[model samples]
Target: MKLPTDIQILEKIYKAHKNDFEQYENDNSIRDNKIFVRVDLLKIAQELKVDKDIVFGRLYYHLNHKFNYQNAGNSHVKLFINRGDYGKDEKGHEINFPYMTSILAGMQYERRKYQMATIIAIISLAVSTISVTISVFL
Candidate 1:
């Protein structure tokens, strides 16, 4: 398919990872949808002077988390799947999934922050309970 310039680049990247992306399809359509996200993130990373390797690493994390790591993770592929065209294979339905590194990083960082907050809240609650119990005894 004749994808836009940006999408063409993205399609190339997706095709590059044919082994990992084969489950989606041997087709390069996955690259088309993911290109927008990768380019946008790359632009932002360039603006921020972030290393491309770092960005790519995070992107890989997103892909693994979305596809391989099923437990305790959201369906990251669903968004891209909704954006692009997917067809059924000999097995079943397949969709193109794009993993944005920045987003994946942010999601992990946010999850950590939430876990920390929950821990703090639990500690505070326990301290309050202990304080109340001591006061009652006193």
Candidate 2:
């Protein structure tokens, strides 16, 4: 049997989980603005009678070109198709998934590093103030 196109697969998964998407949208508990659709690699592979890796490879090939893929734990993957829809820069060009993911990950790492440095500086200043106070008392 011929394999389905990436768009076809995405449509099938979305159709199958329409209720889930709607429920998620209606869920006020979720504060995150980003929405994603999850697809179970194993389930798709079984439905298509193809190897799981092959299915994943096909998805990677198509999605990497436009959408970011996040391994959502277990055998499922999250699709961030909106990333492609939104323009990243002034030029209105969408960055590919691999590069965009890496850039975002790097930004996150830098933010964490800045936070850690701020914490350490605060602690160091506190220690120095305590030492000066003790010296003054002595």
Backbone clash total, candidate 2: 0
**The candidate that achieves the highest TM-score relative to the unseen native structure:** 2
lDDT of 1: 0.44
Worst 10 residues of 2 by lDDT: 86-95
lDDT of 2 by residue, 70-111 (tens): 565644333333233222322221222333344445656777
- How close to the true structure is residue 42 of candidate 1, measured as C-alpha lDDT? 47
TM-score of each: 0.36, 0.40
Q: Cα lDDT of all candidates, in order?
A: 0.44, 0.53
Best by lDDT: 2
Q: Give per-residue CA lDDT, model 1, range 87-117, as digits (tens).
A: 2212222224344333444665777899999
Give the poorly placed runs of model 1, Cα more than 4 Å off: 1-85, 89-99
